[model samples]
Target: MVRKQTELPEAVTIAIASLRDGEKSKVGDAHDLLQDAVLGRQGCLRTDKPQPVDWAEAAWDEFITLMAHDNNHARSIAGQVLSNLAQSVPPETALRDLDKVSAATRDQMFVTARHVLQSMWKFGLGTKEVRRALVAEFADLFRISGTEKNPTLRRFDIVTGLRALFDETGDDSLLQTARDLISLEDDPTYRKKYSGVWRDLIDR
Candidate 1:
């Protein structure tokens, strides 16, 4: 659910503090609060809103720093917040940090990597330059992911992101790329499972 504009300041304050705490040291109430603010509990803010952009703008530097934090959880949370607040991030800042975001997709921790992959698409929503970079980056990732251990899971995520991009921009090429990804899967069972990620578009 969307949050009241008045409540955004407090939430952003807490989230940035929690994010900082996660960076400073691991086990603490800040870590827990950061997780909740970013991932959210059932029916809560869920960290999905763009309204936090104002607050996020203030914490932009901190978030960028946290993106490379030694802790994987901090990196993941930082990446997601940056993506969610992409619209608020200056275009130059987003462009400069795109590499860091790209690197997170290959993070050693699968969960952190997956979170980064899932949210990276939002960076494009901020500007045309970012959209171009994000699309190119994701396409390159799709081309390379087949050699990974969990190619199917990664492809599924890629296609899902492509589908969202298609929906936003009405880009048929994005859908076609997703189809190409599905066709590249050698394992029929995994192929089918991954195709299910685009079932609606495929069937249509």
Candidate 2:
């Protein structure tokens, strides 16, 4: 006999619905619930270990769709959750959807963009190809951020994200690329600020 498929956890289901709700009041609570749910299963955010979740398969497409939702809050939540879900999904799936995730880094709302940018390093926890794709995406972001408002801060985030990825993967090439990107900074003050991100890593 064919058995019935199990349902997603009630909290996850409600959180998704509330996030999609037009009422702004519901979003904050929903975001908190969804984040907690994903993190409870994800364990420490710094680790590269994959703790696959049953709900990830069902929620993956929904989160991807919400990345382009009308509300910027929805977009931000979607982007952040997608990054958290990266390790839960197949490595190839994460690599395939990298561009979609990267697009959120340019969201019209600067806060939304920053949220996405800061979370992107989580994608590097996947396979080597995923890490390679993440590095390429970071390189492109660093190149284009020069014209954006608060370019230095954006570049700082990119460099710091590379550091986080390097920390998780122990990949020397990632660390070298981050230092190389820092060297490209023309302003001494901003370059110094960027370099400081690596001081601890360098010392170790």
Candidate 3:
């Protein structure tokens, strides 16, 4: 059993502060430190299994608040970290904040939006309700992506996220959904690229 932590580590606290500082010089180092701290507690984050962190209870609120920070970097970091913590925090908490984190995918800065999108697949590792809600959210986002800048890229990420969720849950519907979305890509080159994402799954 993991011992619950009651507070953020000093370094993590300092890093969060620096990230909020809005100074470019401090942002980089702060990002590195906070990421390291999160990864250290979360273990191999790429796994389908949820690695609940001891400190997540202490850190969730702060990260949730930072998702709306004025600095895009802070928002990006908050979204990514919150996605990582989805499996660690209570299912209700994760479900409650899901839309807030999803909002970051529409951040004004495309890079920040992409960062949030890339990490959001992890939320599928939460409870069944969260997973279903996330699929619905991704579907809605993909359907409306045509009006967004770099629609193809946004579609690619959405499909990629679905593939990730499918891989983790062995959900056939998710894979089929991804394939169907790929078929809608009018650009042959991009369609092939999107298809490549499921190559291994197709082989299986």
Candidate 4:
């Protein structure tokens, strides 16, 4: 980055160092100095203007490093960055180095995916293509997660819930999924939560 006539290289170096630790990213009220240093409020960062995004771009690994930061909010910021990039960037550009992000981010990935689903759908995932993709990805997750050993299949109710919320087919297919998941359950706990997912679908 091009340094301003009066700016010292060492100070910019120190600022970037603090940013890497996430200490300077508070986005706090000391806007005038922060803007001058990073985003350049009144052209304070003549040469360092490009460095902050560059730092963020580089700190992807650092973000993953901070994934287990003692603070959950810090973890969330890391996930949000991944989520934002996933939504706006082409899969090719955003995921070109998936191997780097994937192995490190297994836990954070689901949290980000749920954010994507919620932010994009703003309701139950509807529409054939969207539900198709959700089913492809999340159906299995929902199925085996609610139980263990002889795990109860919850994908059926989840899919049915989507059909009902969307009023899509609301048909035999959804009904069959319901039956399949319920039949796997010997435990009576699902007699409520699982049943609740499909009661309206069954009646309709």
Judged by TM-score, which candidate is best?
2
Give the alpha carbon lDDT tens digit for every residue of 1-204 in model 2.
Answer: 111224677887887898788368777777767756777653433223334466676788888988878899888888888887786677778888989999898899999888888888888877788889999999988988888877988899899888887877799988788878888899999888998989876535
Looking at model 2, report the run of 10 residues with the lowest lDDT sum: 42-51
Clashing pairs in 2: none
Say which prediction, candidate 3 or candidate 4, comes out ahead on TM-score.
3
Candidate order (TM-score): 2, 3, 1, 4
lDDT by residue (tens digit), candidate 1, 1-204 = 222223345655676666666645542444455445444432212123333334445666777888877778778877776776666667777788888878888888999888888877777666777778887888788779976657667777877777766676676766777777778778899788877877887867
Flag clash pairs in model 4: 2-47
TM-score of 4: 0.36
Q: What is the descending lDDT order?
A: 2, 3, 1, 4
Model 4 residue 98 distance off true place after TM-score fit, in angstroms:
10
Give the per-residue lDDT of model 4 (tens digit) for 1-204: 221223233433443334345554541222233344344343321111212233333334544555455444344444433322232233343344333333222344444333222222111122344334433333444455464222233333344344443443433554555556555556677645566666665556
- TM-score per prediction, in order, is 0.76, 0.88, 0.86, 0.36
Residue 152 shift from truth in candidate 2, angstroms: 1.1
State the weakest 10-residue window (summed lDDT) of model 3: 41-50
Candidate 1 Cα errors over 4 Å, as ranges = 1-10, 23-52
lDDT of 3 by residue, 96-203 (tens): 989998898999999999888888888887778888888888888888888998898999898888888787778797887787778777889988888898988754
